[model samples]
Target chain A: MEHRPMIALVGNPNAGKSALFNALTGAHQKVGNYPGVTVERKLGRLALPDGRAADLIDLPGTYSLDAKSPDEQVTRNVVFGHQEGERRPDLIVIVVDAANLDNHLRFTLELIALGSPCIVALNMVDLATRDGLELDADQLSQDLGAPVIPTVAVRRRGLDDLKAAMVQGIPQHAAPLPVHSEHAAPDADELRRKAREIARRAIVAETPTRRITSQIDRVVLNPVAGPLILLALLFVIFQAVFAWSEAPIAMIEETFAALQTGVEAVLPEGFLRDLIVQGVINGVGSVVVFLPQILILFFFILMLEATGYMTRAAFLMDGLMARVGLSGRAFIPLLSSFACAIPGIMATRTISDPKDRLTTILIAPLMTCSARLPVYTLIIAAFIPSTSVWGGIGLQGLVLFALYVAGIFGAVVVAMLLRIGVIKGPGGSFLMELPKYQMPLLRDVIIGLWQRAWIFLRRAGTIIFVTTIILWLLLSFPKPPAGSDQSLVEYSAAGRIASVLEPVLRPIGFNHEIALALIPAMAAREVAVSALATANAIEESEDEDETARTLGERLQGRWSLPTALAFLAWFVFAPQCLSTIAVARRETNGWRWPLFMTAYLFALAWLGAGATYWTAVAFGL
Target chain B: MRLTSLEPNHPAYVESIDWNAMSEMDSRRLRELGLHEGASIELLHRAGFTGRGAYACRIGRMIVAMRAAHAGAISVRTGAE
Candidate 1:
């Protein structure tokens, strides 16, 4: 294989490096983890003007060569060629924000001092001009002794110039530059001073126009109104996840039913047909139907992130987060956890404090990830009537909101305990930059939604598909003896396992069916709903009427109101997803914290379910 | 006066910093943002009436949000001085 030249894009956080990468790569991007670390390594193929392609690695954003967080450390290691399992880049493209030169240029100066073959991408020049500042790119290029290309990443402006500069900076078959031994790393103070000087010289004209970001922040970050607006936005988001996804969820459900019916009509009555309809179609479909909700939630998150309102949210949340023994910096990660805990825990790299990061990781799963939506919505639809609670609040949406509140309440209590106990220390200081607000680009949001949707659909095809088959096999084996009134499920391998699990979960209102589902659910929380659908579909295979009913309707017939409520309570703290646990381990760099997280969550799940079950039962619900 | 005590829109220059009051990491972060002796700084906005929580300030041209504790460690002199 021919060795492709490697070029790395580096910059400070929120310098529009990702947007530039998206424009350069144009969907030829691969996101994975570096060896033994949870930090994401994003690689793309950038086609140079000379017709040869170069491998572009987007390094984590940093402030200076001096490492602060894990992200910054990775950037430093990659630049110095010390990162394990990563090749040294043949050239470095240092991206700087044009409007914020004094801060961004410090990192640019540091990277330039490394003596690496480099080019400067003065990105977001349009925003700079909009803010009433004019810059001479030639002056900056001369002072830095590098090629400077002004570009606006979102609009794809000046990309051709940037590509030409890259082609000129790196020769064909160029070798990675050896780290400079002569140039000792200057302290940050010195770099800042030099950066300020170069930035002043580059400015041809400046006008003092009020920044749009500050003006928006005046209202968005208002101490009183800010928090209320955040709450309202959150309430609307949760409600929208339920309201907006209903039609799509129905379409998916009907499509799967049709698919199952089609398979039944074409195939002869046998085991293979049963597996196809029950295991793959019904099982995976139960999980896949929740995709609309996940995408809606992710759309809002990606928009908030793209528009740079996420940090301002952190600022508003700082006070409330402080009361829970966390800083505002943890708020972003915790909020991301609502979409999924995997990315949420990974986002903890921005937190500089070790205890803070660990505590945030430990409580991340309590944020009611989108995975839990399947289980929550399934149970909610089965038991809760969709009627007007008050003026316009549906009982179903209110229950969904209550379940989310339950997760957050549990997290707050657990965080307080963890802080006062094992992770005892003074709270870490919160410090962060609130990036300028901009309209979220449509292309970027669509790309992000595509990635999330693909991950979900792929999981349905692979993990959930295989697990359902294995579960189907476990439920189908050792054919029941002739005329044995016992259902096939009760006589199979899964039944024996559930019988053993039943006693343990009995006090928490879990029945034999729920116990069977719990066994497969450990792979992924959404599998609980799929597992039940699979098991029920298998058991009712002979009865056309029972099989025709939806999983929610079937669940309503089998489970009491309290049992359904207990199941909801159980999921609020259940660390049932294997991916979340795996990511937690990788992030914490050991099994210790992950194991602690699992044990505590299981205990809480049991207690919470027991509490909810008994309370509902006593009330005659 | 401490940077936290400075009112919004009042531009000041750092006179001295009680680096001892901060963790090694915190001080390094502040320095990386160009908060040092004689560095131009301004109090942009404070979070609430208590004058606590996050204190948004401008160091050079960068807007930074820091806890009041970190802001309290930096003493500054206004242009009036």
Candidate 2:
């Protein structure tokens, strides 16, 4: 049996390398991390044309072998076989954009110089031809001394040719690209000139380019119109995410309620039954019910990125972000925080500046992720009336908008403080390539959404399920010694802890129930409502009519205006879920930043809640 | 003239890279993006409300943004509007 060889894909940024990897590996891809770093490692099993299988690795994009960013460093190390635990590739597939041939050829040439068995995948050839760009692949292959195959990665064109080329028996000592390494390492200028010289030999422009991308950019990148268009687009996405998910969210809640009822009816009312019904179903359900909203948010985000509009948004935000000691690249990661801080913190890997990236990570949890949505919605619906305030705007909706604003404002303030106080340094400059816009491919969008949904579901099933059970135990244990005349929950361990913490929590208008609920809430923000639901006996119901009461209504029966407002304020600066903190710890490579983040956020939360409580009470609300 | 001093809609040719004012990494990145000496550059827009930073420019065929501090490294000669 011949050993299955390892093949690698390398390319310049935005060269459609990832698209090519997805096309080549389809359905067999798995994502992991590089040893000792958080950079994603995407690998898949590749079935070669010659009936041989290969391990495919997708290296992060870079312009040259000279390592500038951390991502590029990893790619360099892995390619040179200097990275520990990563075997050098048996073959390399260099995916180059035919349209951006000149910019990509420099890196392509460097890879060829490494004396590895390499093939150049000239990706996006269809777009190049349509745009009247002419490139002779044979001429390029002749010039570079490597097989150059034209491919439209999105359409999966030329995979068979690429596969055949990859598995072709080529010695490691084959012809290398011209390199004069003894001449003090050719600078960027010398290397670029060499690349252009190679490009001039094989490339031709068929016409005076009338670029539709330029025409679109003229509007989208305009100083005046650009910001306006971006704002309007963002506004629509925000409104749609909230409005479109309402019915689906309600359906999820109703289904969970039914499940709880069905499960409780069969069991004979014991600890196990209570744990399964109230703890698992109702508790995990509360967290899972917010999935639709998260999905909607992610769907829009994936679409914006696919269409290449996200870069323009970042370009528009660069100045504002720079003023706060962040680069424009931080915008995407910060935006991801609006969905969940875990992924957002992970996304911070894209920011190259260590100080800027750390600051972004620390402030990410303040973005009011979807987990916080359930808490805000419950409080707002209970306290604020749904009656139209402005011409026809619902007051409850207005409160939700205000909460979102509070979270954004909180993030900015914290970032600014950190910028001046702790991580004081000049802001990193933003240099981004705004890729030409294209219609987003539906298949990719669907796949992206499915992955996010699976991740959210897995979290709800595992972490939320286990935490809810522990909470259930806390509220269920220390049995009441046969009719001593107190509720079973109050006699349990959690109630005792709540009673002890009541004095501290009471200043912010939280009662024993809210205080107790805060324990499980550490696992996820959405669990607080469920903890209260079971703690207050609201979960004790047999009929749909009884169980169908919105968590908001049940909450209103107990909380005062001041109390609810304080809770809202607390969420605005919430320290983040445990998972998020754990991610921060991992990302920062130590406990220092994560511990600092928790301390600062808890302080902010306490102060915000305290102020709101006192102010609302002073107004006699 | 300092590249930062170039006005919008005006074209200039980079004459020399006085990279002494910036870090080696920034200078190398600029070079990689084709901002070397003798490369043509056009100021497209100065970003933000007060136009403080992240200036938009056309270098060769690509549109890129950079801070004024980094822009200070490239000395340019006015070409045309």
Candidate 3:
């Protein structure tokens, strides 16, 4: 039996490590949970020299082996083969940032200390050269006693040399350099002395280029201008999301509408028609329609992240974050939560302190994910007039912006409360490295957007598919009263259940239509749109305008303004999506936080919605 | 002087670090930044309010931050004067 070697891909965060891994392994990858943790372990097989294959593991990105966060801990553990059930890597391929090698080397040196066979793939070499960097790869390799190959992972450079080096194997147990230890960590003074000495001897830079990054950072990171610029950037992103996505969203809506009509027409007008048109078509179509918006949001985020502006943004936000008892590192995950809470919660694994991680998880759902977009768009479209403000700024878009702002405020307040009340611990300080800015790689950005779209489609096909079918069954069963001409749904089990639940929700301004929407929204919040579409008996039409007209007409007389606002308020705090809850459970490793999250969120939602309803009614809106 | 009091553009040589007194996470973080004892660093930017104690400093080319409490633990001598 031929024994193939194992090669581990390691790098600092945002060093194009994943893109490189994807380039190397391409469709040969499997994602699994690491033993005893929810952090994803990505493994794939790649062909080595001599026509044999080697296993490749993409380790989580960390700055150094001095692990702070659980994800970093796992990376450290797995690299040193300290993790149970994980084999020691035969060769370690360190992915270093070509432009920012000074900091990247910290981790590289730590990896070297592990005494593993190693090679350095100087990634992002293109960016470094663009910035007028001259690296002596051979000299650096000789200095560190390792083979260093310059690579542009995004452009697929240096793969052959990297692979050849992997197959050739590195010198085993080379003299240990003075680097940070992986385990039995030395005292802080000793580590610093070693780091300084290593830097003094191994690293050298020619005349420092007065880079444009510092000039831009001067204004963007200015105390007064920084926050304003951040606000403006956020405003522009949301405005662009709403403005640019409208055309594509309309197109998707029209397509789905035509498909729904065709499905309804071909299938007999009975159970089969209902299931196909209402459950499968309407349910999946409603959620999938927002794909353009989700993709657009991710596109901008990936662009910002790739260009290295996000780290500076985090640096700018450090003070505010610390005030709320979170490190600056928490900003990335929280910002990601605005796109979707599940991944946002997962990203919190990067936070080192257990208290910070748990607090981040507890409040992540309040970040107004894209799932809430459908509900916000629906309510705002129905209630807020589509008038523009300040020369073509959509009033509806402003309201949508306000809703997002409210969610962020709520999350921060909750985080503050949790820090003081529940997870009473000293907030961890922020210490992050801001990488040099570069134009984002087009390939990586597109691939990132594609991955997000794939995740959304997958969710629609699986969780939303099954839940909608079950909901359709419950809502369509048991024929109406014998003497009545009402549709079966009017007297069905779902209708009865909604009516019974209506009294409890009445104080929150929810009628049977809104109450019925909640049942399906539990699976995924975006499913509420389809639930409402089905409940209102809006027939499938080929034209998007007609579908919008039908929905608007159905809701016009039935829902009061207060009720619409109240429903938005409800979702502002609603613990409706079980996927987020499941992620919270997995991340926390206990039922306690998720349960607490659900209970408190539900209570807050009820109170908030009820307060909005009564307050609006008192004003006689 | 404590590391926290260093003014912007002031260079400092780290004299000592009380690693045992610090949180394990903080110690690990400090090590990652190359800020262990004997490293010379410079305070680059102090953007946040003093009460909150958020500041950015550079050790070589890598910039990092810590709260006032943690920064107070590291002894340094300013080279500015």
lDDT of 1 at A558: 87
Segments of candidate 1 deviating more than 4 angstroms: A1-3, A181-183, A377-397, A530-561, A617-621, B48-51
Task: Provide the TM-score for each candidate, comma-separated.
Answer: 0.92, 0.92, 0.88
Writing each residue's lDDT as its tens digit, candidate 2 over A415-499 gives 8999999999876667767676777777778767887888779878887788778888888888789967777777889888889
Tens-digit lDDT track for model 3 on A531-576? 6776887765666456656676678679998998888888998955
iRMSD (1 decimal) for each model: 1.8, 1.9, 2.8
Fnat computed for model 1: 0.58
Give the Å shift of residue A422 in candidate 1.
2.3
- Best first by lDDT, ranked: 1, 2, 3
Candidate 3 CAPRI-style tier: acceptable
- Our model 2 lands, by Cα RMSD against the true structure, at 3.1
The complex in candidate 3 yields a DockQ of 0.46
Q: What lDDT would each prediction earn against the true structure?
A: 0.84, 0.80, 0.76
Best by lDDT: 1
Off by over 4 Å in 3: A1-4, A12-16, A22-32, A63-68, A80-88, A97-110, A113-115, A122-143, A152-157, A170-199, A204-212, A383-401, A484-487, B18-21, B48-53
Against the true two-chain complex, what DockQ does each candidate achieve?
0.63, 0.51, 0.46
Fnat per candidate, as a fraction, reads 0.58, 0.39, 0.45
Give residue A498's error in model 2 in angstroms. 1.5
